[model samples]
Target: MTATVAAPAIRVQGLVKSYGDLRVLRGVDFDVARGSVFALLGSNGAGKTTVVRILSTLLRSDAGTATVDGFDVAARPGEVRESISLTGQFAAVDEILTGRENLVLVARLRHLPDPGVVADDLLERFRLTDAAERRVATYSGGMRRRLDIAMSLIGDPPVIFLDEPTTGLDPQARLDVWAGIRALAERGTTVLLTTQYLDEAEQLADRIAILHGGRIIADGTLAELKRLLPPATVEYVEKQPSLEDVFLAIVGTDPDSEPADVITLEEQR
Candidate 1:
């Protein structure tokens, strides 16, 4: 007997979206494997955010089929919603509530048993125990980002969407967020991330897709994408030979010689 593999955690087939006369997505197709990180890359208004909102069931696609955790996002949105969590570009925690209270509030809203225990555990897990009693407004940017991510785990959904989770964080703080994201995938959670940071995507994504002009212009492992473009060696040597050195190395500025502007990284399969 042949064993059957489960469907991808996220699957979108011929997805098309539009607003009146403007098309935002153009028949896009992609799949994300179970328990892996998938990164979406694009510049401003490239339809990257639209994809996340659609998959998270926050918006409806004008035309196409999308499924999350085996549930149809359009027909069975509730099931899709229940199976996923999203930490958007901005932290959505309540400012009036204490860090602990905010978590407990989320836990309670999820109808979990003994929210206190879950709240306390997440606080410790995210290293927020020391500030548990502090109002969320008082937390620093990085701390709030951590707490935002921790809040998304209240029910431990199998899939999570992190939309530029480390956008404005400093280097060390960004690393902390990356560590937390890694931990989630290690625990068997499927993660879908959207970011402009090549390093972050290189470190976390199992696969990547780059969006441009409201469509996916490139998709593949880093090496594969790099192969699509020509390679160049930029060498440096002592010198007044400055112009001569650069001219010898790069030759001419044929735009095609440059790497694709929108680059996202993914692990090689």
Candidate 2:
């Protein structure tokens, strides 16, 4: 059998960020193993994006140590930048360029000699081949989002930071992006995703950390976190079963069927 590597893809300790007087991140710490998917969840202003920015070398942390692929984000910023890619909250593709053109531009920026080959490969990988020649301005929201993520892969970085990757996508579009994220993690890319969507965190995260007030309130696997609260007893019914049917099956229903809120094990008193 071949030996497996033990080096972590990302590591951070005492990470802090501030804006004027408000301290955003207060001694944040986390480590992501190579080829794993780690998610950071938080409400707005929880410092999730600030953490990503610092790790990806887009912004400097006020005080901390951050490393990506074993390269220090501050002391070895050039190497750290070369080892990671970041897709911010917004889709950043050039609207005037065609899908193919946008990818080729990224390839060229990476100094790849055969930009056309890289563009063609990414177009097919992202299912954008048919629309490759079409202007990005005419693309749908999902298509633009796909192009944005595809561009991030031009350098094939070992680690990727996706900050609210599905923010504006429709439900179907959101699922498509989720699938793409899963594919990346499966292929040994370490992903640190930040999102407000609980469902997205539940779906793609191998390990999750919840941020509240700029600190990690909870951290664990989904089941571990859910177990922290009461167990959620999920029930299902076929056909036109009323909420009354569900409640009656669990707790005796009132004669009026009162249209009361259903309580799961988590919400039960």
Candidate 3:
């Protein structure tokens, strides 16, 4: 008997887009499996964002086809929008509103019943219950990002498109966002993430697609893609803690540090 394979939650084939004389996407194709994190990794100007914009129905592709939840993005734009939520590079949050109020606002916008209850539940889920009443302007970058992601969950859309979710965040804030993303996949939400940071993709994606010059040059699981490189030769090198290590040990920082201390300590070496 032949085994049947499940269809991807999102699919794209021969997708092409251009801005006047510039072609941002050239025959891009990929698949995002259900309940998985699929990362589109590339550097700046590699058309990662363009692909995202097209898939989310915010922009039309010049050619090819894309489907979300089996609904054609071009032919059925309404249904495509219904099946997905998009979070852009920077958090699109209202700075004046309290975190709790932001969640309630989104829930109400989606016309969900018991909006307050929904907001309360999400605040607890994202570990923002304590900061819920504080204005977003006063919250840390990580807190704002967490609340931003929390707001996107109001309607429980099946697929989420996160465009460089941690772009400007500090290390700790990035880690916090990473944890939230893991939680989303664990709960069966399909996440499509686009980022330029290799480590970010390494840390988050279940499968990765390397986009270069407007095309997918590589696509596979982390292990599968790594195998494309030349075989590694074993080498043993002494492991030593650098000055940054000692500095962190003396005073916790790198995230919050004294520039004077950094210069003084490193200069001594």
Candidate 4:
């Protein structure tokens, strides 16, 4: 007997969307396996956000179909919402509230019993336990972003949409967020993120889809995408120091700098 294959966590076919005379997405098609990271890459105005909005039920597609966890996005918005969480371009935590309060608010909104316990658990999981009582206003950008994701997990949704999640983060913060995203996939959550950063896609996606002209122009694993391009002629030249090296030379070593900061700078470059 043939072994069974699990259905995709997300599926879209011929998806189209428009605003008045402006067409945003056209004939897009893709599938995301359960517990895998699927990245949608596009330039600005390439309709990346449009796709995310539609999948999360914030916007309806003008044509075609999309399903999350087997429930039709258009026909079963409630079910779709129940199965997914979304963290948009900006952090969504309340600035006036402490990190713990923000999480507790989400838990209470979710109507989960023992909201305080849930809040504490998420705080600890995200490594925000020490800062849990500090108001978000005093938190760093990375901390705020982490809190946003922790808030999204209050319901333990099976899928997550992170739309340009690290857009404005510093190099260290961006890597920190990337680690959190990987942890999510390892825990069996389907992650669909849209990003303008090509390296981000290359670093995280199990599969990638390039959206252009409001359509999915290419789709595959990173290796498969590379294969579509002509092979480069091999050449060797003297290696030159990168901008990072220049930065390090100028700044020198700071006794106060954390070791992790050095690792983050290297990884980003």
Residues 1-269, model 4: lDDT tens digits: 99999999999999999899998887899999999999999999999999999999999999999999999999999999999999999999899999999998999889999999999998888778989999999998988999999999888899999999998886667777898899899999999999999999999999999999999999999999999999988999999988756655644443225543344556678
Residue 73 in candidate 2 has what lDDT?
Answer: 90
Q: How many backbone clashes can be found in candidate 2?
A: 0
lDDT digits (tens) for residues 1-269 of candidate 1: 99999899999888888988989999888899999999998877778788999999899998889999999999999999999999999999899999999999999999999999999999888878989999999988888999999999999999999999998885556767888899898999999999988888888888888987777788887777778887868899666655535443443332225543443345323
Count of backbone collisions in candidate 1: 0
Candidate 4 — what's its lDDT? Answer: 0.91
lDDT against the true structure, each candidate: 0.87, 0.87, 0.91, 0.91
For residue 113, give model 3's deviation from the true position in Å.
Answer: 1.4
Query: Which RMSD values do the candidates have, in order?
Result: 11.6, 9.9, 3.4, 4.6
Cα error, residue 196 of model 2, in Å, equals 0.2
Candidate with more favorable, higher TM-score: 2 or 3: 3
- Model 2 has an lDDT value of 0.87
Q: Residue 97 in model 1: shift from native, Å?
A: 1.1
Stretches of model 2 off by over 4 angstroms after superposition: 1-5, 232-269
What tens digits encode model 2's per-residue C-alpha lDDT throughout 1-269?
99987978898888888999999998898888889889999998899999998998889999989889999999999998889899999899999999999999989888998999999998888778889999999988888888998999888999999999999776657767888898898888899999999989999999999988877878889989978997678889577876646645654322223555666678766
